[model samples]
Target: MKLLIEGGRRLQGRVRISGAKNSALVLIAASAISGGEVILDNVPKISDVLTQLEIVRAIGGRASWTGENTLCLDWSGPLEGELPYVHAKKLRASNLFLGALAARQKRVKIPLPGGCNIGSRPMDLHLKGFHLLGYQVSMKHGFIEARAGKIEGNRIYLDFPSVGATENIMMAAAGTPGITVIENAAREPEIVDLAGFLNAMGGRVRGAGTDVIKIEGVSEFRGARFSVIPDRIEAGTYLIAAGISGGEVTVENVITRHLQPVIAKLQDVGLDVAAGEDRITVRRRGDLLPTDVKTLPYPGFPTDLQSPMMALLSLARGTSIIVENVFENRFQVADELKRMGAKIRVKGQTAVIEGVERLYGTQVRATDLRAGAALLLAGLAAGGVTEILQAELIARGYEKVVEKLGALGAAVRVAGDESGEPGAKSV
Candidate 1:
């Protein structure tokens, strides 16, 4: 799919945020361990989430949408140990099923998952975590298989603070016989949300927003109702959209505390940002000032927002530097942005962005999810028309992106659809 964008219009008004995609995917997998009906609220209706539901149903589990944003999952039926690779290969989150199904079925065989090729996502850490939890793990024929004679818990130390490994290990440990401890665990807000959901479902998990996490195995789990946290990345994207267009806009349904890194960076770029309990407002004045950014783990500038920030920096007065510490090949968007009249140079994991007076809209392609967001924002601030190919890729992480952007007063729509009207045929 393609997105036809009209540039140079300031996007203003309020855009409500959706639930975190990263959190929802893992939480949906965690729901399978309950062995009964689990109700999840604030779930985003996106392609990735829908694919997860399909995978669950394909394996004999039942999942459906009870309401607009409510998902009801029941795993009472006998679930297969292996997920159909056809459905699993579409997303990286499919790997999460290993630990989830391992606990229920005692053995799991899942294919290597695929998603945005931001970097190398090795299964070594996750495999090691499973091994520490008394599961014999192996990879053969491009599939990961783990089996355990007796589910037991053990202490595991991750070489890096990998979020997937942490969540996978936590789920597997939650149903074991003993207590499992994870050192150097990921401290993202999504991790806390997952831990909260596990606890709500009668599992014992402690210390989620910290380096050390403790999971006390329980013999069984029951269905529970939980609400996922707001998507901070989505909120930050709209906040940057406001800054790039020199407009005053507010994003609601956001937790201010989860956006500290993004908020600080926008303020450094000469934007006025104010936080009220659960919403944030951003406004741009004169020319934006350049700032240095380094993408780190939680509590640092997020790598997911790095692309959109670069788009805003493209119009700054001076030069800005960005270092991506979380993922490799993240600079793939640099070449595409330069096609839109931005001066950006890439070297290894660092990118140097030189600001220009203005940008002219041109044809571009979305290399990945965040890269698509950067291009969309740039198109909003550029002059003339901007045609973005592979626009459907953005739907993997964002919900109602075109609808929300149109509501914010940006003229964007699906290419070659319905009288070229904004929000026409946008999926």
Candidate 2:
């Protein structure tokens, strides 16, 4: 599918934030180890979430949506030990089942995961953690096989604070027989949400939002109910959308504390940013100020929002520098932005962008999930019409982007069916 956007439209209104996609995936994977029904509220109906649920169903589990934003998963049946390649090949989060399945069935055979071609996202840390838990891990014929008579808890330290490794280790260790202490664990808000879900199911976990997380193994997990946190990346993207379009937009249902770094960066760029208890309002004050950004872990500038911020910085009055520290190929959007007449130079992990007076619209392709969002924001701020190809990448993360942009008064719509020519149109 493609997105057709008419540029130069001021987006002004209030839009409610959806649940975090990162949190929803981990929560759904954690449901596989539950003993009863797991009910999750405020879940985003994105393609990634649906794909993860399909993997669960393929393993003899049942998942269904009871409401628009609510999901009920029943995994009490006898689940299969091997994860099918057909379902596991669609998403990166499919690797999360390694730990859940190992904990439940004590044996797992899953294909090497696939997602956006962003960079070398290795699964070494995850495999190492599994080995430490007494699982015999092997890889051959493009599949990972792990088997163990029993999962034993032990102290494991990650060389880097990887979010997937932390979540997988925590889930696998939840059903073991001893204490598992994870050093240098990821401190993202999604990690905290997963810990909360496990705890609600009678799992003992401590220090989730900190670097060191300790989990005591339990014999079983009961069904539990939990709500996901608001998506900070989506909130940051919409806030930058308001800045790029020179409009005022209020985003509600967000946790203010989770966006301090993003709010600080927007303030540094001379945007009018205000935060209340659970909402934030952003408006373009005047000419934007050029700023430098470096992507880091949580409590710092997020790597997920770096691309969208680059789109807004393209229209600033001075030169801006961006250093992407997370993913090596994250700057793939720079070439797409250059297609729209923006001055951007990328060398290795750094990008030098010289602000231009205005950007002319052109056809661009989305390289990844966040890159898709960056292209959309640039299209909204460009001078003419812009058509975005491979917009399915955006739907994997963002929920109802066309409908949300419309509610905020932007002229954007999805064009072309699976058998039609790609095109754009104004709504």
Candidate 3:
């Protein structure tokens, strides 16, 4: 797939944010624990999500799209054997089911998960947490097998604040027979959304969105409907797009509190951002000012938005330094932006970007999901046409990207798309 984008167009319009992909994936994986008819509303229509639904059906669970954006999951039938490796290996969230399946089934085998190659995302912390939950976990020959009978909850102190490990351990403890306390847990909003979903399904989880979380095992489960929170990453990407395009754009269906760090960072970059109850409007009229940024966990700048911010900073007035404390390979997009005539230098985990007055569009590749977004933003601001290959990777995260950008008056079109149609209609 290729994306042909014309440059120097100001994006001005309102774009509604989709459901959080991180939240939806884990919640769908966690839905396997209670074996009830779980209704997930506002589910993002993305490729990773479809892959998760395939895994659910492969494991003897029932999943169907009840609405355009609603998914119903029911896991009442008997499930056995290894998870389909073909589907599981395509998603990093597939490993989350190790804890969920371990709690429900005595033994289960699943392939090691895979996803964007942004960095090394090992499962050592997850396995350590599982061991504390009474499951013997091991990796052999590219596969992980966890086995235990009548799993019991216990205290787990993570070595780091890993969101996947925290969610996996929480799912493992949801159906056990005792209290499980997780120390140094991830303080992400998606964690809070998972806790809310578990409680709605009769699992007791407290203190999510904090460093400590408590999950008390329950014996009974029931069907419940829940809506996921808005995608803050997607909203942040669009906000940065507005700043880079020097336009006035409002993103709807977002939680302003969740965007505090991004909003502050954008203001530092010279974009005028206004926060409403459920929307944020970004306005920029002139050249942006360069500002330093660092990627951190919750309550700090998100690593997911680091690439898009780099794209915005490329057009800034001076030098900008970005310290990536999360993924080591997060600076991979710097090279792609440089192809568009941006001045960037990468050393280890830090990237020093020298803002240029203008960028000349050229061809680039999307190394990963966020990198795709960064390239798209650069294309919008470049002076000539920008061609981005592997545009399909962008749909794995963002939903209706071409259509959304087109609605905002961006001159972009898809070519050689997999779908018979010539746009992001598949999204």
Candidate 4:
């Protein structure tokens, strides 16, 4: 489907955010290792999370919805075989099950994972962590097959605190025979949520929100019900949308502290930002001021918001410099923004954006999830209609994006000339 974002009006409304993508992804991995029924609440219905549920079912597991945002996963059935290649290549999160599968069956075969073309997100860290835990891994043809003599817990230090690798190793070490200590771990709040869910399932995990983590091995664990936290990234996106469109928007069902960096940045750009309990309100009255931003890990400006922030800074009064320290190829959206009459130049990891009075609408393709969001936001600020192709990328992350934008008074719609079912143009 294609999305057309009509620009030049202030967005005005309240938006409710769904469960976090980062937390839900790791929770899927946690559920794969549970012994009984695993109940997960407040989970978003985004394509990536659905892909994870499909992956679980493909592995001979059963998943049923108790509510719109609640799912129960029962893995009592035998895992017929490894994850199918067709499903495995759908998203990068598919690779996370390797550690869980290896812990469960002692052997697993999975195809190379695929996802957005944001950058070269290699799995070396995950593979290395698995190796440290007594798993003998090999790649043959296009599948990765791993066999563990027995999962032996040991000290695993990640060279970088990669979130994916951290969750993979934690799930694998949960059922192992000894203590597993992971240093230099990711301190994201999602990591804490995963640890909480695992602990509720009778697994011993501690220090999740710290740089160091300790996991004591247990023979097995039973499933329990858990509620996921709100998506802070989505909250930040709408907050920026409210700022750029000169609108007053209230974002509800969010953890206000998690958005400190983004909120601070918006306030720095002269937008009125206020937080109340679980909601945040952003308002814009005048031209956005120029600000410099650098992306970092948790507690820092998130790398996920860098691209959209670039779009927001495009309307600043002066040149804005954005340095991406997390992902190398995240600047793919720069070209797409430039297509819409935006002035942006990239040199290595830093992008220099020159503010412009106005941006004209144009056709652009969403290269990745966040890039798709950035393009859509840019379209909302442009003068005329903007056609965005590859909207499936946006669906991977944002749930009901067009609906959310429309609720905020943006003239957004899904339209394409391709032949399909009727009303397929406005989904």
Candidate 5:
């Protein structure tokens, strides 16, 4: 469905952020390995998470809603033949199942994952991690097929800090015999949350949210109640929404430290940010100024925010250079921003942006989840009406985006293409 956003209003409201998408995806995949039932709380009603859950059930796992924001999973049943690739290609998170399914079923076949046109995120690390755990991995017919007689724990070292690889190795090691140690592990909070959920289900895991992680394999696993951490990315998006729109907004249900990089960048752009126990407030008193930024792993400027920051920087007072060191193809949104009258140029991995006094609203398409958000923010801050297409991409990660923006006083609504009726409403 498409979205029509009328700009020229500063959004102001208290928005309670939902659970982390980065954490919830891996947590759901990890829960499938536990022999008993697993209950997840505070889960976001996102399309990608639902797709992952569908994949889990397609593999013979039983899933049911326990509450408005809770789901119960049972993964002890017999394995299905193969995962449906058409559904898997809808999002990249589907690749996470390679490790979980391989460990549980001993043999698994899944399609090559797809999501966001950001860049090429290879599965080499995931494949290598599985090989370390005594699995034979290969790709054929555009699918990843993995087989193992029995998973055996071993030392695995990741060349780069990859969140997907870390989660894959963690899931594979849960049922293997002996102990597995992963060096140079990803330090993202999502990794720790996944470990916490696995531990609650009788899996022995330690040292997450750090460079080193250790997992002790067990013969069987059970389940328990798990609550996902608040989404820092969502909080950061809301903070940006308030910043560029020149509004005062408070975002709740989040860990302040998780958003240090984002808060720092906002402050650099001349926005006032106040962090309390479990909430953050962003207020812009004057015009924003451009600030140079580089995308890195955790504790550094996240690559996920690169697109949105570009939108904010478009209205800055000076020129800003943003170097994307993580994903090679993350600058896909640069073209879409250009449609909205923003000046941006991409040279290889670096993006040089020139600040414009104001941007005029126009039609654009969302290339990815964060890119969709960046466009929406630009539309809200731009002059006149802005139409954003392929808005369903936003729902893959964030929950109730339009509704939240409406509550914050932004004139945003969904509309049909030729038909006047909008798509089905969802939170």
Candidate 6:
């Protein structure tokens, strides 16, 4: 599918942020460790979530949505340890099941997971953690097979603080026989949410939001209810959209603390930002100031919001520089932005963007999830009409994106089909 956007519309309204996709995926995978009804609230109905739910069902677990944004997963039945290639090859979160399955059934066979072609997201850390837990890991015919007679808890240190690796190890260790200490663990809020879910499932976990996390093994799990955190990246994207369109927008249902770095950068770029208890109001007063940004882990500028910030910086009054430290191919959106008459030069992980007076809309392609969102923001800020191809990539992350933008009064709509023609309703 494609998105047809008539540019130069000022977006003005309140937008409620959806639940964090990152948090929800890990929670869904963690549900496999328990054999009861687990209720997840504030879950976004996105493609990625649906894909994860499908995987849950394929593994003999029952998952259904009881409300518009709530999911109920029942893992009371016997689950199949093997994950088919067709199911695992669609999303990166499939790798999360490795830990949960090994903990539950002592074996798992899953293919190498796939997602956006951003960079090399190797599963070595996940596999290494499994091996440390006494699992025999092997690869044959593009599938990973792991078997363990007993899961033993041990102290494992990750070379890098990888979020996926941290969540996998934490979940796998929740059912071991002893205590597991993970040093250099990821400190993202999503990891904290995973720890919270595990704890609610009768698992003992401590120091979740810190670099060192300790988990004591448990013999069984009980179903629990939990609510996912709001998506900070989505809130940041909307805030940047307001800046790019020179409009006023209020993003609601967000934890402002999770967006400190983004808020700081937006203010540095001369945007008027005010944070309330659960909402953030953003307004653009005059010309925007150019700024430099470097993506980092939690408590720093997030890599997920880097592309959207680049879109806003493309229209700044001066030059701006962005260094992507997380993903090597994250700057793929630079070429798409250049297609819209923006001056951007990318060399390796660094991008030099010279602010243009105005951007003219043109046909562009969505390279990845966040990159697709950046293109949409660029389209809204451009002078003429913009057609974005492969908008499905955007839907994988953003929930009802066209509808959300339309609610905020942006002149954007999904194409009727792949022909790039606008319709009365969005996809």
lDDT of each: 0.92, 0.90, 0.89, 0.87, 0.87, 0.91
lDDT of 2 by residue, 377-423 (tens): 99999999999999889999888887788888887878753322222
Off by over 4 Å in 3: 416-427
Q: Which digits, one per residue and each the tens of the lDDT, describe model 6 over residues 344-378?
A: 99988899999999998899999999999999999
Worst lDDT 10-window in candidate 5: 418-427
Candidates in order, TM-scores: namely: 0.99, 0.96, 0.97, 0.96, 0.96, 0.97
Superposed Cα deviation of residue 396, candidate 2 (Å): 0.6
Model 2: which residue pairs collide?
Answer: none
Global CA lDDT computed for model 6:
0.91
Best by lDDT: 1
Question: Residue 25 CA error for candidate 2 (Å)?
Answer: 0.6
Model 5: CA > 4 A from native: 416-427
How badly does each model clash, as a count of residue pairs?
0, 0, 0, 0, 0, 0
lDDT of 3 by residue, 282-397 (tens): 99967799899999989889999999999999989999999999999999899889888899999999999999999888999999989999999999999999999988789889
Residue range 301-328, candidate 5, lDDT tens digits: 9999888999999999999999999999
Worst 10 residues of 3 by lDDT: 418-427
For all predictions, the C-alpha RMSD in Å is 0.9, 2.6, 1.9, 2.5, 2.2, 1.9
Candidate with best TM-score:
1
Mind sharing the TM-score for model 2? Answer: 0.96
Please report how far candidate 3 places residue 398 from its true position, in Å: 0.5
